[model samples]
Target: MGKMKRILYFRHDKIGDFVLAWPALAMLKRALPEASIEVFVTPVVASLAEACPYVDHIILDTGDDKAIRAQIAERNYDGIVMARSQVRTMFLVRGLGVPYVVAPKLHWYQYCYKHRVNIQMGEGEPVWRKGCRLTERLLRDNDIPIPSLPTQYWDLSAERPKWQAFYQKQADSQLVFVHAGTGGSSGSLPTSHFVSLIRQIHEQTEQPCQFVLTYSGEERKLAEEIHQALADTPVNVALAPPLDKLVDFAKSLVAADMFIAGSTGPLHLAGLHDVPTVGFYAARRSAVHVKWQTLSQAHKRLSFTPPPGRRDGRNMALVDVDLAASKVAAFLNQDQGK
Candidate 1:
């Protein structure tokens, strides 16, 4: 392999999918320090892509196939790693004469890739590791040594102070961000469940907490209702002020002592900072708690799932939020005790 200099890494997926690939992307950069890495991302996550420290460039895909092909051709990439490959993406780079192209064996386009790693076909492996496997193949084939990925990669130092100053006002309270909306892999908890969980946590907390209810789109009403339901409660609760950009919201997540949400993108963002996370997952194979688990450490994250049985994964109502809240409150108390 003659010193590959330019690489285009594809993670043109959803927000959470893109974030999970961060470590693998970082691994590629470490393995080839001189190569300029470019990531292909959806417009929804373009801002967050700019904040990635590992990659030198970002190519925002606007779903225009012609424009995408033009952009890919313009770069004259030395290699392309289809970390989150789609049928469209496979076709786009098909005959571009790129020196090296690698992807998981997904579509019949497996014939297109000179190197294909069998990933995403398995159930137990985490998504990040799947991406890393692709990077490993790229390294071994190119005679480069595979390197370890950092547990935490992005530098939030600059973004941290903004929340630090705001949090200073409530010096005695822990910052808990509870996102009411989710990018659906499964059904989310109902408003009543969230309210019950919040009330339970409030009742059992070892220390005071400032609950910041966060929501996107139509879930605003759900967040508001949770706030209204807790009006008479003694614990402090507030609505999270609207953030203009996804990057800004991501920055805010780093400051959280604890983050709570359904299996979603924001939880993965909190995972980036290693904030303690409490998440709800479905029991189905596709949305299993382990599959979508946060990037937070095992000890620092808590997960709940609906009971396992026929159709149980879609049964959000069967999830025992009260019990979950009790255990999670205990987890928080344990942390405070330490």
Candidate 2:
């Protein structure tokens, strides 16, 4: 009931997880309009939090518990909301001496097992809103009003100049963006698969459409391969740099006709921007890990798992890239006709 002057929001996940939590942050801002909302994120994803509209400060993960404790103690935060239930975070909050602390109730062992069982759990919410129930519950317990899911908006004027240039190059044709990497080290489609999918689309469409391939950090190799594969073809493929300037990457995705990608942040980005997306879900995780705005009826989400008899020791599974491509092409064709 009292005014919350300063609050800490701890989400030490990857890029996609942070993006998925944007709606929650937006809701929290609305609920506590006067509070200074700071986010604690890993170093790799700290930049994203800095670019979020609702976050006022960012604490980078340095893997130094003492330093983290010192930082939190010095800040004198009014409350701490641990969006992630990691043991490190729990220990950190306990040492901060905050008046209010909120976290998920699962035991450390169960939490670890859940993450091991499915990497998607490491991301955040699951499909049908089952995984994120804990997030909602945490907010409610802290008297934070739940923000509406599937938030949507568009701002063409705010787009980066490069995106505008890319748009102009296509002339009057529809543009489809294809992203093939996820936030994790693996779990992305192989270059050969991506090439096959793009080639199929190009042949079917008679080279009328443009394909933009995006990658981040080490995944640039995959983007390069896509470009090489489409070199002789009419499809245009290029690597998109991490748009550090944009407040929300989700906003950029709104300008696209359709988004096709492996399970990754861009897929979720498309969802937040309300772009129709077709995602290739790997067998290592459930489809629930894929975060999309609930309002997006245009999305086609698929998960590929090997047959029980073909199960290998490795958790990875091969997705049907051709099927995913067909769905993407069909979705785009429908949108264009409309």
RMSD of each: 1.9, 5.2
> Alpha-carbon error at 229 in model 2, in Å?
2.3
lDDT of each: 0.83, 0.61
User: Per-prediction TM-score, please?
Assistant: 0.94, 0.76
lDDT of 2 at 87: 69
**Model 1 spans with C-alpha error above 4 angstroms:** 121-123, 167-169
Instruction: For candidate 2, write residues 17-47 as lDDT tens digits.
Output: 6766666676667667787888888887765
Q: Which residue pairs overlap in candidate 2's backbone?
A: 127-288
lDDT of 1 by residue, 132-236 (tens): 888888888989898877767666857766875654427676778888776666468887898888888988998887788887778789899999999998868
Candidate 2 differs from the real structure by a C-alpha RMSD in angstroms, to one decimal, of 5.2
